[model samples]
Target: MNVAFTSRTLSLSRPQLFRGIRKVQSSFATCSVLSANRAVVYTSNGDPSQVLSALTFSNLPPPPPNTVNVRFLLSPINPADINVIEGVYPAKPNPNASLSSSGKGSQDEPVFVAGNEGLAEVTNVGDGVTHLQPNDWVIMTRQQAGTWSTGMNVKPQDILKVPRSLNDVEAATITVNPPTAYNMLHDFVQLNEGDWVIQNGANGAVGQVVIQIAAAKGLKTINLIRNRNDIASLTEYLSNLGATHVVTYDELSDKSFRQRVKEWTGGKNIRLGLNCVSGKPTTLMTRLLGQNAHLVSYGAMSKEPLSLPTSLFIFKNLTCHGFWQSRWYDSKSSGEREKLVETLVGLMRAGKLKEPSHEILTIQGSEGDEEASQKIRHAIATLAKGQHGKKILLKMEETF
Candidate 1:
């Protein structure tokens, strides 16, 4: 282990540095992995072949400075993660380390881990790392790659340290869905007490969090979900999270749905419409908003293109924006991230926040575990099956 004594006043001795070095080494149960060499690659885009065995691809060692060796404590597979492996997702590549040698850094390399986000703990810290000690919990500071494996050696700047109080699940889920909901609610619209917000995919990871957050902040929510026979059950469940009204897409398509929302909200201005679904759903949502409201699109799960009237943009003065939580969170310091995590954790501890509903699946594959991948596909196929939960995780491990 290398040591940097920033100031003469510093107190780490030789023995302590030696201990830190030992602590920084990654020890995984899988001995077949030689992390110092090539990483496992997903050579092509397709089915399970797309997430095929981490075949070898040659690469140099970890890039220099401001980097760290990270051991994956856990990587949870969410829907977007499955889309990435299928090679259909817009976002691309997950590299554990990028070639920062030329200053563009290893992060630029195309081949990397496949997860958009996951939780990790530090194993080694290169020069200039002070805030993080070995074994400290962290979430990715950037997006794409390097999160699906057992461990990775990456830059310190790409990993955001979590508050000691945050649980692994919350930490791993930090980078994308949760923060997207957070920023959309707080950043785009200037919401006020008693204001109302409407959103699609209400039972989604982001949507569920929005329900609770909006309620916590004294704002009401009108949630939208796809048609399910148990729609009534789903409604009651979301209402428990503070949603004011829960309606189906068919219900939403009704000419009176907007009137119902306006009536339910006591005609209080609905300032924000969160869209993860495009096409007609988004078009109808745009009309539902109060004048000058913001319509934020974060995903196009419907796979259908967006179509809307120009009159809304011209006359209603609506502002349309796109958001990516990964990009926004990457700009903050480790310190700021820890604090945001602290607030979220505090909510969790106080019963204000709940885990995303999930069905844990053990990964079992011919060469490795395939259960995680299978379960992921299942989750995507039947997303609206459940009334109030999102998949907890799709984890890859050596043994069941």
Candidate 2:
């Protein structure tokens, strides 16, 4: 499939893109009406390649009270999204979505749209809504908001308005990995400047973000990745992102590397450890932490269970915790969510954070349903086989 890859740079000249919505208004102007919409959906829990398909339906009517109609600008195909389609994820999609009634399935066989993270533009607002207006950019606040579609009607409360200064890629991909990195660095541990953080999977998306954010805050990071043929290039790339040390799992497994890590940190305690690939390597990571250090795990790319010696917990006073961005969103109110977005946007503006390296998989509105469906399925299949290293952002245009 022909796809486009690009990383958008920050543009600060257009801040007015995000304003308005001070008080409840009696009436709001709406944008040009779109007549048709399309989405990628699945009817059963199975391999995305076999179960996923493209769905087309009539444009959603004006939203109900307290809700707004939104046109999705861009959505991402994340690993968790694939897991959700495979029925292995904890969070499930809302099966009763109005988009299901497009005659694709019935009550006996409900159709569910795929996608959890995206950026959208408000096209219409219903009564009793005050915080948003047509054309304002927003992102889904609820898990499984069914964002892999051209448009949908969503409750205003379930979406958070974001700055327009952010490019399509930054806004679409911000909801998951960035927040995971930011919160893990800030919430679980009280890290001071000149401190040390060690994390495996340092070349992955979230790991890259952690390296930059920690560097921005004046903390040093020891990044670890799997040994590969391109080890030298990868290490140099991460070093350019402010990683103090970039070593492979092979180097980490060496007996003398522990003393080298000690010397690198000037014998200071490594107070924070982030693990996404859980297994023997992670256990080795825990052994390098200081007393009272916190170990936060977010993913298990290796699919191996974490097994750590009890001596580390007992003698070193180590603490282990799990982090999920969905749970963090569920625990915060709208105001708090807004603050989190605001803080991230500030970092973007200050050049401390950036849009992830990504490729655009555009499902053209002009294409036939079968053609579109085949493209989406092929992309998911490729991702499942670990072919694409950059993030995949889906651009579902409104059907004319």
Question: What lDDT would each prediction earn against the true structure?
Answer: 0.68, 0.88
TM-score of 1: 0.75
- C-alpha root-mean-square deviation, candidate 1: 10.4
Predict model 2's lDDT versus the native. Answer: 0.88
Clash number by candidate, in order: 27, 0
Task: For each candidate, give its TM-score against the true structure.
Answer: 0.75, 0.90
Off by over 4 Å in 2: 1-35, 100-102, 105-108
Judging by lDDT against the true structure, name the best candidate: 2
Q: Model 1, 66: alpha-carbon shift in Å?
A: 5.1
Q: List the candidate 1 regions with Cα displacement exceeding 4 Å.
A: 1-40, 48-51, 54-66, 94-111, 125-128, 330-339, 363-389, 397-400
Candidate 2 least-lDDT 10 residues: 20-29
Residue 1's lDDT within candidate 1 is 20
lDDT of 1 by residue, 130-165 (tens): 778788988876677557655566777677777657
* Residue-level lDDT tens digits of model 2 in 204-321: 9999999999999999999989988888888898898889999888888999999999899999999999999999999998899998999999999999999999999899999999
